[model samples]
Every structure is written in C-alpha cells, then in structure tokens.
Target chain A: GAGVSQSPSNKVTEKGKDVELRCDPISGHTALYWYRQSLGQGLEFLIYFQGNSAPDKSGLPSDRFSAERTGGSVSTLTIQRTQQEDSAVYLCASSSRGGVGADTQYFGPGTRLTVL
Target chain B: AQSVTQLDSQVPVFEEAPVELRCNYSSSVSVYLFWYVQYPNQGLQLLLKYLSGSTLVKGINGFEAEFNKSQTSFHLRKPSVHISDTAEYFCAVSAPGNTGFQKLVFGTGTRLLVSP
Candidate 1:
C-alpha cells in the first residue's frame, strides 16, 4: 500500500513569496496533520484535520500559516508572505482515525522549503 | 500544553552493542507516547507507541521502549543494533481532549550513529 505522500520534495523561493505544499494521505486515512522541522530542532505541530469536523489550528505558528483538506483526503499548507524563519522541512502525516489513542500516524518524505 | 524532551542529542555505539535513547515528557493530563525514526533522505516512520497496558512496548527493527509513569519517561532501547540503525529518533506525546485530533508535541531528535 502506498504511504502518505508529499509533493515538491524541495522548494526554494523568495522570502516574500507565497508557497503551497501539498499532501496526499494514505487511502482511507481520515486524519491528517502538518508539521515543521527546522535544522537540529524538533518537529513542530502546525495543523490537523479530522474528517469533516473543524480543523485544529492551535499549533499553527501564526496567521500567515494556513492549511485546508479537501474531500477529507488531500491537504495543502499555504504560507503567505513567507519569512526566512519559515525555511524548514514541512512534513505531512495521516492516520486511519482520529483521537488521542486511535492509531499511529504515518509520515511522508516531506517537502524541504527554503526561503532565500 | 504538552512538551517532550530528548535528553541526548546524539549517541554513538559499535554495531551489535546495546543502546538507549532517553525521552521525557511533561503534561498535565494522560498522554499517548510514541517513538519515530527517520533515516537519511526518508520520511519519519513509527518505531513504536505506548497508549495503555503493559509498560514495555516492542516496535519494528528490534526496537523497544518502556513507559515509566513515575519518571515521566519513555526511553527507547535496543539490545543489538546494526549499522542501518544509524538515524534520527524522535519522541512525541499527544494529549486527550483536543477536539478529536491527536496533535503531537515532539522532542528534539536524537541522532544515533552505529559504527563497526
């Protein structure tokens, strides 16, 4: 079976430009999440979507960061007016279900976003 | 809010030797614990998880972890490791009651280097 997948394995853009990262969750996975991993740092939660319910945006670092999952499968994280601080490996993950103890999340290879 | 701490930034050991990566978490509520491994140029993979029941949880690639509630720790241990075991390890925690989403808080990863 195919695991979660992300597009544009690497992206380099201007600091003021906007970038959109895409994620395709494993088929039938109802919960999806996005995270950021800076060099030599931990994975920072960004946002999450569970079924048709409201997406959990608490972990989003700022208003410039936003994500939307359409049809409960594919998700896109868009960063508006990217800053050099937004340079990092953007990772996406998905699980069969939602909730704290429901299932283990499988991760994608990630898209390395570099703001120059 | 929950947070995770990986005590060691890096651990180097000879092939076939025992190794341990320490992880501690802080949260006011009960949480689910997980260990993820990331090989170079690859995505993160689930090594193991501890949701409930037995304290010892076994994971892929001969890795295991023990959850200690009193110590607030979930350290990963492998009796014998291969050169392939050289990679990054991350510890994460997810608390309940988060609007049906399991948002993870991750620790700064520990880089494992196995030498012959």
Candidate 2:
C-alpha cells in the first residue's frame, strides 16, 4: 500500500516569497496534519484537519501560516511571505480517524523549504 | 499545550551495541505517546505507541520503549542494534479522543548511528 507522500522534495525560495507544500495522505485517511522541523529544534506543531473540518489552528506559528484539507483526502500548507525563519522541513501526516485514539497517524516524506 | 524534550542529539554506537534515547514530555492532560523512526530521505515510520495498558511497549527492529507516568517519560531502548538501525528517532505526544484530532507534539529527535 502507498504511504503518505509530499511534493517538491526540496524547495529553495527567496525571502518574503510564498510557498505552498502539498501532501497526499494514505488512502482513506481522514485526518491530516502539518509540522515544521528546524535545525537543532524539535518538531513544531502547525495545524491539522479532521475529515473536511479543522478544529485546531492553534499550533500555527503566525498569521502567515495556514493549511487546508479538502474532500477529506489531501492537504496543503501555505506559507505567505515566507522568511528565513520559515526555512525547515515541512512534514505532513494523516490518520484513519476523526478522533485521536481511533487511529494512528502516518507521516509523509516531507517537503524541505529553504527560504533565502 | 504540550512539549517534548530529547536530551541527546546524536548517539554513535557499534553494531550489536545497546542504545537508549531519552524523551520527556509535559502536558496538563493525559496523552498518548509514540515513537517514530525516519530513515534517510524518508518520512516518519511509527515504531511504537503507548495509549493505555502496559507501560513497556515493544516495537519493530528490536526496539522498545518504557512509559513512566511518574516521570512523564517515554524512553526508547534497543539492545544489540544493527547497522540498518541507523536513523533518526522522534518521540511524540498527543491528547486522546477528538481533541487530539491527530495533533502531535514532537521531540527534537535523536540520531542513531550504528556502525559495523
């Protein structure tokens, strides 16, 4: 079976530019999430989608960060006016659940975004 | 809010040596614990999880983790590791049920280097 996957394995962009990272979760996964990993830093929570809805956006670092999941299948993380601080590996994950304990979340390869 | 800490950034070991990666998490509510492995150029793979029941959980590749509620720790240990075991390990925590919505708070990660 296909596992979670992400696009643009690596991305290089100028500061202040915008970038959109895509993720395709495992088939039938109803929950999608985004996270950031910076050098020497732990994985930072971003945002998540359950089914076609989003109940938690608190992890989003700033107003420029946003994410959406449509049809309860795929998800996209859009970083507006990207900054050097936003340079990191953007990882996506999905789960076969609407609730947490119902299923385990699977991760994707991740899109590495480098903002100059 | 929840946070995770991995005390070690890197651990180099000879093949067949025993290894331990420490992880600590802080949260106000009861949470589900997980350990994930990431090989080079790949996404995270679930190694093990502790939702309920036994405190000691076994996972693939001869890996195991002990969940200490009093210590709020989920430490990964592997005895007699293999060269193939070289990779990055991440510890994560998430609240259970709908509030979890698959959201995870992850540790910085511990890189395991198993050499022959």
Candidate 3:
C-alpha cells in the first residue's frame, strides 16, 4: 500500500551548511536506496536508484556525498559541506525489482541528520 | 562487489531466553538475502528472506533465518523473545533480477535488548 516515505523526521545541520534529505518510494517501487546510520558507519551504503539514474555510486563516502532520483521516483541526499561526521540516521529504501541480482527492500522513517 | 557482515553490535536477551542475530555475507556471485527490523522510531520491516528453496527461513515476530550456503551465513533466530524485540537489526544483500532496480548491501546494525 503506502509504505516507504522519508522526509524531515529530523535534521539539524550546521557544521558547514548544505543539507537535503528526502525520499518517497513504494508506489511501485523501482528500487531506491540510501543508507546512513552513525555510531561509526553501522549502516553505510550511500546511494542507489534504478529508474531515474545512478548506476552505483560506490556507496559514496567522499565528495561530501550526493544522490538524486527525479522522474522515476523521488530520492535526494545532498550533504555538501556538512560534517560533524555527518551526524547519522538517514535511511530510505524501496524495492520490487533491482536487476543485478536481488530484491526485497522496504524501508523509510529516517532522516536524523544532525551535524552540529 | 558485494559485502554484508553483521556480527552483533549489540545483543542482550532475557525475555524468553533464545535469540541469535548474526549475519555474514561476501558475494562471489549469486545473492539475495535479507532480514530487517527496526522498531524505535521505525523504518525497515522485512524480517525474513532467503529466495531459494527452504534453507530454514521463517520470519515475522516469531523470527527465523538460516541460509548457509557453504557458510555464507544468514542467521537470525528467535526461540523466545519479546519486549517488542527491542529495536535495530539489519542484514542485507542483493543482486537477483527484475528491473525494479536492485542494489542493497547493508550490515552494521544489531541492537536487540529484550530484557525482562
């Protein structure tokens, strides 16, 4: 039904400024993911989208992190200057299919991001 | 390039007295396994997956997981656990089929404290 959906459950940036986190998946789920859960990279895997773009950003960890998914669905993860270790808790997921070899993902209700 | 290793970040049981949450993965090929559960604040919810033909996979509340192909591992058990099963727990790996857009590889979460 209506499962995946992510927004500003919580965001408090400041370290360097620049923050944007959002996700909305589940309408048809075409594979979408972005993970981050502090406590020393306990939930890494930073970018993924199959309909809009993104082949596999390599779990992005450098370049301040980045993400995008427009027409196919909705996904955004921009952390530019922010750092304080980038805070934590930023998750989003969606799946119905994911071609390389795997499927079964459904998550949302995250966006802690607190880089004070 | 697939990897998943959730070797317990936290596990303190008591409620029922039988719990095991340990997942391991390192793809050489063929992949698709999952077990998601997040309670406090909410997000992930899969709880069970093995894809193939029974390797001992059962999920939802009662919990159960076992897909050990040569010991690649996909362990998540629950003989007697409650207290809402505490919280956090994730172990993912993907790359199967369809086009929904698969790309999952999570492991670095395990926080289940079911005390009495």
Candidate 4:
C-alpha cells in the first residue's frame, strides 16, 4: 500500500509571498496532522483533522497558518505573508483513527519551505 | 498541556556498542508514548510506542523503549548498534485533546552518531 505522501518536495518563496503545501494520507486514514520542524523550534504540532469534526487549530502558530482537509483524504496547509522565520520542514501524518493513543501515525516525506 | 524533553542533544557510539537515549515528559493526565527515527533526507519513521500493558515495548530495527510511569520517562535503548543506526531520534507524548481525541507533543530530538 502507498504510504502517506506530500507534494512539492521543496519550496522557496519570497518573505511576503504565500505558499501552499499538500498532503495525501494513506487510504482509509481518518485522522491527519501537520507539524513543523526547524532548528530552533524542533518539532511543533500545527493542526489536526478528524473525520467530520471541526479541525483543531489550537496548535497553529498564528493566523497566517491554516489548513483544510477536503473529502477526508487530502489536506492543504496554507501560509500567508510568510516570514523568514517560517522556514522549516513541514511534515504531514495520518492515523487509522483519532483520539486513540494506541493508533500509529504514519508520516510523509516533508515539504521543505525556505523563505528568503 | 503536555511537553517532552530529550535532554541529550547528541549521542555518539561505536558500532556494536550499547546505547540509550533519554526522554522525559510532563503531563497532568495519562498519556501515550512513542519513539520515532528520522534518517537524513527522509521522513520520520515509527520506532516504537507505549500505550498500555507492559512498560517494555519493542520496535523496528532492533530498538526498544521502556516506559517508566513513576519517572515520567520513556528511554530508547539498543543492545548493540550499527553505523547504519546513525540518525535523529524523537520522543513524543499524546494525551486527549479538548475534543477527546489524542494530540501529540514531541521532544527536540537526539542525534545518534554511530561510527564503525
């Protein structure tokens, strides 16, 4: 079976521009998550989506960061007015189900975003 | 809220030597624990997890972790390591979210430098 996958393996953008990162979770995965990995911040959770439930936006760093999962499979993380500080590896993951501690979340090759 | 700490930023070992990466977490409620490995230029991969039952959990690539409730620690250990084991290891914790689903928190990460 195909594992989780992300598009645009690498993206470089001007500081003030906007960028979108996409994620395709494994088949039948009902839960998806977004995280950011940077040298200064390590790994930080950004957002989460569960089937039909309102997305958890608490982890989002700011209003500039937002995400949406359409048709319960593909997810897109959009960053508006990007800053140099936004440079990092954006990772996506999915699980068979949400709210269960025992469920395993599989990850995808992250999209590295560089803001200059 | 939950937080994870990987005190050792780096661990170096000779091939076939035993190694341990320490991890500690803080949370008010019961949480699930996990260890993940990330090879250079690759996505994060699950090494092991501890949700319930036995504290000793085994994972892929001859790695294992012991979940110690009293110490609030889940340390990864391997009896012997190979040069191929060089990578970054992450420790994570998850607890119920506001919506009653699990949300994960991750540690800074420990870089394992295995040399022949």
TM-score of each: 0.95, 0.92, 0.34, 0.97
TM-score of chain A of each: 0.94, 0.93, 0.32, 0.96
Off by over 4 Å in 1: none
Each model's DockQ score = 0.66, 0.59, 0.25, 0.74
Using lDDT as the yardstick, the better of models 1 and 3 is 1
List native contact recovery per candidate, as a fraction of 1: 0.68, 0.66, 0.68, 0.66
Which is better, 3 or 4, measured by TM-score?
Answer: 4
**Top candidate by TM-score:** 4
Residues A67-97 of candidate 2: C-alpha lDDT, one tens digit per residue: 8888888788899999998989988888877
For residues B1-116, could you state the per-residue lDDT of candidate 4 as single tens digits?
A: 88999999999999999999999999998889999999998899999999899999999999999999999999999999999999999999987776676777899999999998
Candidate 2 has what TM-score? Answer: 0.92
Index of the highest-lDDT prediction: 4
Ranking by lDDT: 4, 1, 2, 3
What's model 4's overall lDDT?
0.92
Worst 10 residues of 3 chain B by lDDT: B95-104
Cα error of candidate 1 at position B83, Å: 0.4
For all the candidates, what are their Cα RMSDs to the real structure?
Answer: 1.5, 2.0, 13.9, 1.1
